[model samples]
Target: MSASLTLVVLMAVMYGTGVYVMLERSLTRFLIGFVLVGNATNLLILIMSGPSGTAPLVTGTASDDRMVDPVPQVLMLTAIVINFGVTAFILALIYRTWWLAQLGDEGDTLSDEHADDTEAATEAVFNQVDLDDEAIQRVLDESNEHGDDSHTTRKGAGE
Candidate 1:
């Protein structure tokens, strides 16, 4: 097929793969997906830039149609910088996630039994009380006794 047709198909495949991989729970997969999508975006910007024409800043006389719009090129550069920053931030987050997940031994695997156990553990952790009523009352009472001098203590509206 034609070059443009090939690029369109490639872009579409990139978008599809990016979306599919992003849906995975793995951080590495997500990062790959993000990069794929970003690359696809760059390709889209490049393709939409239209046919190449004479340089806009050429000294010789040139018709308006012959001069390329440099805005898309500028935008593509800006997007590249922005994508770099965003990817860097995401990479940091992925590193942190991987580091945290590495706390367990090397035995951790995505087996069905492990998944069930993980779900149970997650449920147990989530079921824990976020706030203890008695503890909150004690803190409030202490704060009141101290005339709420602590900066971290929160006072009720009526108090």
Candidate 2:
């Protein structure tokens, strides 16, 4: 088999794996998939340039047939850097999501059983309150007695 054919097969497998993992709910799996896809793309770029015959440096005696293309190598280097940045950004997003959810698990935390319980408790509390009733009038009267302004003018020009 040719190098190009092998590279194509490898890239296809990598992309397939990445797509499968991306559908998963785990953040770690998602990151792994992203890395695999990135590496496959980099390898594809290298393979498309054909075999590297010689060094890119000008030795003054090397022939054109012996010289290899340097553009692919340069592009690969840039791609690697960009991939690193993307991975870092993805990790940061996962960390932030974890912090907000107060759990180490990835995906939607609201789908968890504990979140359902919390929602039920909140609903129970809200059900006891009549928002349109005169109970709010007593609360507003107390606030007014404490010198609280229900409608105050702002000093800003936007108001």
Candidate 3:
């Protein structure tokens, strides 16, 4: 019916689409959702300002009836720039994720062989330290001796 009401409807539709797209797992859909949300927010701002009253600039013989509210327009400009930045960043992230996915390393959801390798590596790292191993014992001894020597040297230098 009214222009303000139409804008409100448009904003609601945009928000609904955004919410739906955000639920999707695909990165493209998520990006679209973010854009939709940004647009919806911008539209809401415009609608809340009501109809433009008159020219924003002051004139020598200006009437009070028609001065447009320039605040919403300024806000909309800033919001558009911010949205553009966010969209660009999202696209870059999507590109990086796609590149990684294509490189045969699909993160934690790997194939059987890769999963097995990952499990083995994780187990190896978490395994108990074997103090009985001759090499490990020797390394530990060396480190202790080095530490003692360093401490002695520092003490002597301080004195």
Candidate 4:
């Protein structure tokens, strides 16, 4: 059976709105968008499953065409479980962010401790490697002065 136009339109709207909401910086909005997108995917699967039919296990049913397809239902259930899991994970993240925000003087900003830690980590990585352009150029020049043959020895031309 053909999919209904109304459901298709609704699904499209849901998908569009979900994507739009997901672009926001707020974790809550992202969670809402994720849920909307998940439900829209379920609707899409339903629309594509075709017309409903009798149970596949029903006794005395001789024709396989009349049996309902179970794949779509299974997929929908799987999607639901996955959505729930991701929602929980997002909630946890939101809670963690809120907790961190609370520790700072600003209502929405991270604490100075976190910022200092981040800066320290970044400095540690770059300073340990001496990643500045001048240092890199000096290292390259030193390696050249050492000679390329340091890595490999060439045989005599006649030997």
Q: For model 2, how does the per-residue alpha-carbon lDDT over 1-159 read when each residue is reduced to its tens digit? A: 147777788889998998888789999899999999899889888778777687887778847668888999999999999999999999999998775675333322355667666556655555666554567888888888655443442324337
User: Which candidate number has the best TM-score?
Assistant: 4
Against the true structure, candidate 3 reaches a TM-score of 0.61
Question: lDDT tens string, model 3, 7-46?
Answer: 7788999999999998999989999999999999899878
After superposition, the stretches of candidate 2 with alpha carbons farther than 4 Å from their true spots are 1-5, 103-159
Candidate numbers sorted by TM-score from highest down: 4, 3, 1, 2
Largest lDDT belongs to which candidate? 4
Q: What is the TM-score of each candidate against the true structure?
A: 0.60, 0.58, 0.61, 0.63
Clashing residue pairs, candidate 2?
none
Clashing pairs in 4: none
Which segments of model 4 are wrong by more than 4 Å?
Answer: 58-60, 105-159
Cα error, residue 112 of model 3, in Å, equals: 19
RMSD of 1: 9.3
| lDDT of candidate 4 over 54-139, digit per residue (tens) | 77675764776688888999999999999999999999999988756644343323556566665566456557677676788998
Candidate 4, residue 118: the lDDT equals 56
Superior candidate under TM-score, 1 versus 4 = 4
What value of lDDT does candidate 1 attain over all alpha carbons?
0.78
Estimate every model's Cα lDDT from 0 to 1.
0.78, 0.78, 0.80, 0.83
